[model samples]
Target: MAKTLKSWLQILLKLVNSTIGIVGISMIIYSMWMARVWQRHMEGSSDDFFSFSVIWFILTFLGIGITLCAISSFGHIAAHTANTHCLSCYMVAIFLLLLVETTLMADIILNSDWEEDFPEDPTGRFDDFKDFVKSNFNTCQWIGLFMFLAQGCSIVSATFLRTLEKRQARYCESDEDDIAPSLPFLYHPVEPLPCTVADLPGAPSSLYWC
Candidate 1:
């Protein structure tokens, strides 16, 4: 019963890891593509406030996200195989991903300086930007938040799975030890079969063959 439960838990972890990784990769690709489009739009502008470095920064974060997603496969493999070193590596990957995502969320949630620029625009740029974001980019932010939650879940699941692996190893060892005492009797050498009374030596008219 314990083995069955462990098997199910491992399967659940694999599914969680795979689903999150695929979704994360797709999100990174979509975000990077959008960043490129924004960069092209900004490149045609005369404003000096728009910086290509900002786009590059965004791209860097997205690239990190992609790398994290790629490494998630290793986590799944480690969990399924119950490899302690591999699980440690997997935990590190998950931790790094969580760190990056938390940093991103913090950046978005704490930066209030953009409001200062809202009052200086004469060409309705600020209003247009807000409108565009409300209509489109808002969903992207929510998706990023969801990614944070998913990565958090991966961290937790991987941790519990690691513990489960250790418990399973101990259980197996204990099971083997419990059955070890009976092994000698179970595999003891066999003796020859007993002969019938007619096979007795020096018995006349015995029916036994040589």
Candidate 2:
């Protein structure tokens, strides 16, 4: 029963990670499309600064997509194997991710001068980022909050699965202990059957024939 539950939990973990990965792919695709559209719109432009800024933002978004994709990949591995090390590393990575995300969100919500907190990019992309965030503040915040919750849920589920793994290991060890005492008896050597040419004075053949 415990093993069955663990299998189901692994399935759930894979599903959630796959969903997150799909979202990352979508983000990557959208960012690429936006970059293409912007490039086409500015085909004949000579504004280097603006072009650079747009490119920088596009790359930033692309990086986020890649990061998420990577996290999802790690999650898939951890789920499939249920290895202790993998699970522990995944939990740490996810926790750190959550911590950073929470911090950024808190800064956004609580700090009016959050823009000042972000370092200025050489290509002025930070200004564009600020504009974009301000324009889509509500949607961005909600999405961030959603991801925060989802990531937390993933960690919690993974932790539960880890505990289950430990329990399963312990159960196996106990079973081995119970079986160990009987192993010698179970595998004891058998007496040799009488040889065809060996006949003894006893009822059954027990010695070489004269």
Candidate 3:
């Protein structure tokens, strides 16, 4: 039963790691595309829809690559017997990576030309193009800042977990090595005591005969 449980757990971890990795990769690709679109739009080119897509693509790819590595490391930790500290490291790394991606998304969504109310132009000379660029820049900047903050939080959490695990391990070891005295009641035997009826104040006469 224990073995079965362990196997199931291993499978579950693998699935989770793989799913996250795939998602991370996809997000990076999408971010890159968005950046390109932004860049194209800014250059008055109809081929691109956004002017900041290049920057977005670069940042996203870097963040995603780190995230993927972290996830892979987590899978290794989950599948094998490793120090809890190592697992904690993997968790922190993955968290930071995800945080970056989230921040980028938030920035793009917030800064995009969603509010420009400008008509789309095939020739890139639309009056709304300037507004669109300004909006996108603001959104991207905010998103980058948010991503940094999220990564910081992830690092902090991971550090806390790591410290806790280390402390727990130390406590366990101390208990094993320390020869503390046990309580007397805990050491007492369960057998009944041998006693005479005469020793009891409430003993009956028939008990004394026995």
Candidate 4:
């Protein structure tokens, strides 16, 4: 039988969900490394140019990434098992990530100047905004963009993918009914015996049982 739309969507969402987890975990690791580097540099620096709060912020962001990984794991489980409750939790996590990513993207687009932030060289050759992002944006920003897209797609697909618990229960019942062994009739009608020559008359007296 052909697969249902929900099954296809579940597959797609599971792939995206796994990608998000991997990317999120990588980002967390990168952030932690950066934080450690900054800490080591700050220890010997005479000038307080960079605050320790940056490390805290990085750690906080890493925490968010860890949370994303957890949510993605749950989503995978939900997709595999068709668990409605787990799917709901996964949706909630995707929505929250969507909110955060959207907010960050908006902040970057609204407050930051692409041209000024990435000024031209001495030859006055400047990269376009697209190229500027490719050359200048940090790993977190890039990963966040990817995460945003993945989560958005996942959320949309999940709406169609999440199976209804009641419907699933009914489907299970139907499958059991199909597989269950049916009992044959226990009370078959008794067939009447044929009349023989011996049963017809007194000749049957010796042959017939009392």
Best by lDDT: 2
Off by over 4 Å in 1: 31-55, 58-62, 111-138, 185-210
Candidate 2 per-residue lDDT over residues 1-210, each given as its tens digit:
887899998998888678778878987997787667666766787856345444666777788888889989999999999997898998898888778877887897799988776445554445666799899989987877777777887898799999999988998999999999999999999998765565556557565543
Each candidate structure's count of clashing pairs? 0, 0, 13, 0
Ranking of all predicted structures according to TM-score, beginning with the best and ending with the worst: 2, 4, 1, 3
* Clashing residue pairs, backbone N/CA/C < 3 A, model 2: none
Work out the TM-score per prediction: 0.60, 0.74, 0.37, 0.60
Off by over 4 Å in 3: 1-11, 23-70, 114-175, 178-210
Off by over 4 Å in 4: 1-7, 42-54, 107-145, 163-210
lDDT string for model 4 (1-210, tens) is 224756777789889888888976886886677566556766766745244343444555578778878888888898887677777888887888777767766776797664464333321112232475577669647765776788888887676666444466788899888766543444556687765434556564545432
Query: lDDT tens string, model 3, 1-210?
Result: 544554554555455555555655665675466556556556754454433332433453557656665566665564454356665666666676666667756675787755344334443323343466577988856754754553454344344445555676887889966645565557878886675555556766536422
How many clashing pairs in candidate 2?
A: 0
Please list the C-alpha lDDT of all candidates, in the order they appear. Answer: 0.69, 0.80, 0.55, 0.68
Model 1 lDDT tens row, 1-210: 767776776777677677667876875876666666665666767754245444444554477667867787787788678676787788788787677767755765798674663235433333554687788887967876776676666677777777877887898999999999999999999997766646566777666442
lDDT of 4 at 83: 72
